[model samples]
Target: MLDTEAFRDRMATLPHDLSEYARVQTGPASWSAHPHAEELSAWALEDHVDPALVRTTALLVDISPTDVPHVAVPHADVAQLVSHREAFVVASINGEATLETMLDIVGLPSGELLAIICSLCARGIVALDRSHRLVTR
Candidate 1:
């Protein structure tokens, strides 16, 4: 038999926000996303993904099983045909490559790619290394 009374007691003791997702700024701008809000990640930026991240950021393997996880938009439920342009960015992040170098080498327009990176950052799959690389944390 299920213990409904016990379940109610336990639920009452827990904080309301226990499962609440944490809000994070997508960039210096007003964009935001809740990494833990849903089973699948979703990012909703205001105007666009920040460019400075592209200028000064490099991605490191965080939640990826390998140094490079398939460079998708963090597996979110959105539509934009954001292809795997950042694979080079992720593959080259040997803790030595810089953001500018990735952009130059990949040679793709930086907007969608940057958004994908920022989405990864927001989702906690990757983080910006202070030493100028992305990393798992």
Candidate 2:
């Protein structure tokens, strides 16, 4: 028993541009410095649409859970994009480690970690290799 009219009204009330609502006030300088700021902001928006799932599917379409997650970018470059727990996940990767291993090491909820990974991937800061392993672009 759903109220179709009410649902339509509620949906109409939502912002036409969710990204406008999601935009962070990083100031003018940050926006200019970071070429991917808008993309990141779009990724940060957590509506019913899952950006992580979309990005993961598009980029690693053939990847499996067993695929090893590796950090190919230099630590200094990674510092610019990730912080806190996300940084820990990037740092914990050494040589070869699976997604499960990263989860165990970072101890973050899967959704949160996946969001971070999606953000990095979207920024061209991380990528997947032909071997189907996560890597830095």
**Number of the predicted model whose lDDT against the real structure is largest:** 2
Off by over 4 Å in 1: 1-88, 132-137
Top TM-score prediction, candidate number: 2
Measured with C-alpha atoms, the lDDT of residue 85 in candidate 2 is 65
In Å, residue 59's CA in model 1 sits off its true spot by 13
Task: Kindly give the number of clashing pairs for every candidate.
Answer: 1, 0
Instruction: Report lDDT per candidate.
Output: 0.46, 0.65
Q: Which tens-of-lDDT digit does each residue in 51-136 have in candidate 2?
A: 65567657545545555656667877888877776777677667476666666777789778766665666666665444754565
Query: 1-137 in candidate 1: lDDT tens per residue?
Result: 99999888767464466432433433333323444544322442333556644433434333221223233334353223323544444544544444555555566676654556655555444355444335659
